[model samples]
Target: MNPVAVSIEDRVLALITEDELVSLTEALVAAGGENPGGTEEATVAVLEAFCLGAGLETLAEEAAPGRPNLTAVLRGGDRPGLLFLGHSDVVPAGEGWDRPPFEPYVRDGRLFGRGATDMKGGLAAVAVALKALKAAGVDLPGDITLACTVDEEDLGIGIRAYTRAHLGERFSGCVVAEPTDLGTVVGCRGDSYIDVTVHGRSAHSGRPADGLNAIDAAARIIALVREDHERLQQDQDALLGAGSWNVGLIEGGTGTSMVAGECRLSLDRRLMPDDNAARILESLRERIAEAGLERDGFAVSAAVTMEMPGFRTPEDHPLVADAVAALSDCGVASGIGGWTAACDGGFIARDFGVPTIVMGPGGLNDQAHQVNESVSIAELVAAARAYALLCLRHSSPA
Candidate 1:
């Protein structure tokens, strides 16, 4: 802790220089930790090198094979600390870019690249903030840890493994630096991927009476799915609003001359905090059977392939209040909000038993996983200042 009490905001704001922020952000953006290719190895190396250069005690361990989670600890007093969390992985670049996605460059005050907005930029902001706090000679009462994990874009096993190993440890709080356009996020919707397959008998099209059309049977199931989604509109949460589901894919039919023998539909369901994925899946199965669609040469089956739980931190939690105050300290107008997409923070909230808040630099849902992705340079710098202030306020001795 500082010998004399002063404005933490001013100290933090003055410490993170503009040139350092831009260079760090660009380096992270250029890493290109695309998950579809595989979990990031190169990105982890870059983060490790940076931490070593900063003289922070760092650890690089594999959460999964070749998928590393890097943690840089700025040790302070012995007490519960704050964890600044972010992921190193990004979704694969599909197409459409004015320049190469991996070559990060700045133009018109925005940093452009594949992972610039979704999270790598946020990680860079956290890194710079921690370095600035050290350079300013500010003493902390508790440790400040920065964790950049892998495989968040896919199954989230990286965070899951890391949290599981560190379950016994206590953290004062955690801030998941997922882009929220500088807003503080307190809750997020859960998501599940369901595969529904409908079976039918095949017959020649010339003899329509003999054929049990699988496509026709699939139509009934589709109707029921749509109706269930509409009914789910009544199940709402204060921050997340109503639960929702969408049929993203449907495939059926062997040929134009034959009745389809099978149909498969892929569903994406978004659940509120209290919604149970197992119960929801079972309900879908029961509804299909109860509707008498299982007979008459029509059979339906559904399975959940991937799922991530939702989380909501109470409004009165100290973490939420602290985050709001931290943003104010940095001169950014921020309010508590909800994120519509599922993120790894859910695992820390549910499994690790830590109070978590999500905040970072860019428009989270708008610019992420989109063509020509970019992040505002100004927001990047401001986020670093906000994070530094948060540490000064929360991790300092009373």
Candidate 2:
């Protein structure tokens, strides 16, 4: 495939207007695709309708009931395609906001809403970028696919199921439009949810010495886990820094007068690309054993509830280079970076065997689920331009 002898950048920029981008983002923010009780159906409809109006082929498939993953494709070049991926779901809008969480509003040049900075804004930018490319009338070297998945905040069934269905498809590269504040994220830490249960005997308050206290055993386990967390800090990755763990929740003890029978602990552990949940759990169990928790009356068991793998793309990868160049073209000064929090890109990179980068508008490490989560309008426009340029630069055949 011969390269089209035209500068596709200017054409793409010209077609991606600020007004439409803001309007699209505002509408999406208003849709409230908050997870927990999903409403991705409505958000998917909005994105699919926008894609259809832009003369792109659109598909909406539910990862689960009412949780739809939306995809749009613009066939341009015949080379291996590029996928622009993002999530339609946002974390539930909790409390303490200047305005209503779902009521989209703009003030001081920032779009304030629940999904504004986290991803919905980025999703809109990618959609408009594709529309701009289509409107530019430039021949692309390969196809461009824009996918908005559901349930990214929770279990990530959206991307997992989508990848399971499209595993045979090949892409030269993928860019997850996760909020990077216009920077490119080359790697991220993975996450795991773990449960630790400590079992013991219950007895009356007067006979406390006769029965072992599960909460006491749990406290010992927590101390050992904290030691494990500190120990992991010594094994750090250059990009992701270091692995860490936190005991997020703990529950036990039925009454103040009786000895606690059982204790349950929920933990969140961050992993490097090379780490796995099984190994981490094994390490925790070892720690428990070292703490002398496995005895006649006291026993501890650890189970992994969820595990998401992490990934890192080398700086020389074509996908990363092209993204950096595109950001440069957009007059955005960006360098390769890493994300402390995991994202759906990890799934794409791990399962699909595609080099994936996290890049988008908004703050580099912006607070997404917090009260008054907002994104800069100017940054979003820049992100749109950057996405358009990246598609032309990376997806086109040399």
**How well is each residue in 16-55 modelled by candidate 1, as lDDT tens digits?**
8778877877787787788866658888888888777776
Per-residue lDDT for 1-398 in model 2, tens only?
23343455665688999899999999898888888777788888888888999989988888998788888999875687899889998888988988899899989999999999889899999999999988887687788999888888887789888898888877888898988888889998999899999899899988999888999999998888788888888977778988898999999989999999899999999889888999889978887887787755697778998788898999888888888888887788998989888988888888888898999887645457778999999989989988888877775333
RMSD of each: 2.5, 2.2
TM-score of each: 0.92, 0.94
Error of 2 at 90 (Å): 1.3
| Location of the lowest summed lDDT over 10 successive residues in candidate 2 | 1-10
Which 10 successive residues of model 1 have the least lDDT summed? 1-10
* Index of the highest-lDDT prediction: 2
Global lDDT of model 2: 0.86
TM-score, predicted candidate 2 vs. hidden true structure: 0.94
